[model samples]
Target: MECLLGLLKVKVVRGLNLAICDPLSHSSDPYVVIHLGQQKVKSSIKYKTINPEWNEELTLSITNMMLPVKIDVFDHDTFTKDDSMGDAEFCILDFVEVAKKDLNGLPDGTVMKTLHPDKDNCLAAESHIKWKDGKVTQDIFLKLRNTETGELVLHLEWVSIPGITH
Candidate 1:
């Protein structure tokens, strides 16, 4: 049993129909916070809009594919504590599978045939393949959900390290 290190890239693209936390005002300032394992990253605040385009990227070193990544949307409040808008989560193992194509007894990258929503009630997102540094990278779109109230779009990439197993 050998362990390998993989790099996970998460890009918070945008939000759609986000929750308006401030009832006193017409709109609310919103931002996104992403959590992977013990690492957390926050996107820049988008003021006065329900739909915001962040286009921000964060990278994390991943050793376990069984863990789920958590994403939370919040309203930025200057006076008080930030209000929670909504949240969603997804697991890497949900997309990754053992491929029939193997190299030297190691499995190759598995292709996801269809986009499907996870247990978190998020919309199905798109996925594709990207090559970098002579290795395969799994790129996926993560659609964050606050039930039917709101949705967020995120781009996630899993970069595989050579000679890594499991």
Candidate 2:
């Protein structure tokens, strides 16, 4: 295991047009799982909604800043194994680069960086990393890949350990 450099705080805000894993009920009990390297963390399950509003915060100990953080949505089950809704991954390196910038004089909503959708990512639309609420954050609408349809709304923030410089 590598030395922990910081904690990547992820807010799984909500889902949009998520896959209906429960066929009989025509809905899904959705939850999110986040991964960095071999470490994984899961959010609380939001029951019976295709557009579930999680608004849950989960954190992962990040050692390497270059690795992409992976996100997967699953439908919880009672008797059987949980079914996968879809998956997406975001590059922390991108966010970290912008976070290192001096935003002290910038306005609250000033756009720092604009990232467009690409084959390498699941971004549903253009993403902007900016300073909000005295923190550096990026809100993303990730278009889940490898299934019919789904989108996830996420807020990502990087918090470095105090007195530790990477």
Candidate 3:
């Protein structure tokens, strides 16, 4: 059985009002690391600030849509290990559903959809039929928490290729 591959584009935009784990210290040096199975990518570290702008883009090849992607925020430490700030997880299939609702075809005949962020910081989009080479773009605000408090701003685009099935 030949499985189809999908292209997942993840943009680590920025951090907003992140929690300061080291309150007695000056500030926190924060960075983000995203993982999907064995594939992992890290963003640039922002030194001494609760708010950091990464503006980095990462691409991952996906064979299964059901797998969840994890995004973890950490504070860089020199002597000690990096401290975990917070993390969030999302599935690619959710965006696929959104893409299938609102459909737009490009000049090259590539179908695309746009998912907008809601007032409550939730993400939702429309989709349509014709799954060949379909694309979905979404801007989402993810709240990260694990015994701490923080939020991560991310932009994602999921592209599906035709002629392949998993």
Candidate 4:
């Protein structure tokens, strides 16, 4: 059985300059789906927009920190199947490591670490894991891979379960 590590709250904030999936309309209805092992969560569909503000919060029960959380953006369709917009992923290990340390003296908005986008990872730009509002959190900007044009902004927070034990 997989051991339950803790809960992670991922906030799908918005999309930026998404692809034009719909030809006639010049816009597309987009939604986000998050996959972490067997747990899959989806955000509500935002219609007729390249830049959509979802402000959706999804919680995932993390079993392994090494496993990456996959994110996919899709264009919703009423008749045919939804078209794939793009995909991105992020790991929680580094974020969790910083959260385990003593960050009492750090000022608000202090960046603990900066993760650069590379060929292996889907980060569009420099992602900063910051200490904000008395918690370990991250704001990520991902350039959608395998697509012509698209971007996503996400916020992540790790919550420790106090009574969880092996």
* Candidate 1 lDDT by residue in tens digits, 69-141: 8888899999899988888877666444422123233244434344555565455555544333334454444
How well does candidate 1 match the true structure in TM-score terms? 0.73
lDDT values, one for every candidate: 0.67, 0.87, 0.71, 0.89
How do the predictions measure up, each by TM-score? 0.73, 0.92, 0.73, 0.92
Q: Point out the worst 10-residue segment of candidate 4 by lDDT.
A: 157-166
Give one digit per residue, the lDDT tens place, for model 3 in 5-107.
Answer: 6778889998888879677775789999889877898888999899888899988877667788888889998899998888777667766565435355544
Candidate 1 error regions (>4 Å):
1-4, 94-111, 118-121, 124-148, 161-166
Off by over 4 Å in 4: 164-166
Report the CA-based lDDT of candidate 4 relative to the real structure: 0.89
Could you arrange the candidates by lDDT from highest to lowest?
4, 2, 3, 1
TM-score for candidate 4, please give it. Answer: 0.92
Per residue, candidate 4 scores C-alpha lDDT tens digits across 82-101 of 99999988878888778667
Tens digits of lDDT, candidate 2, 49-84: 999998888988877888988888899999999999
- What residue pairs clash in candidate 3, if any at all? 99-127, 100-127, 100-128, 101-126, 101-127, 101-128, 102-126, 102-127
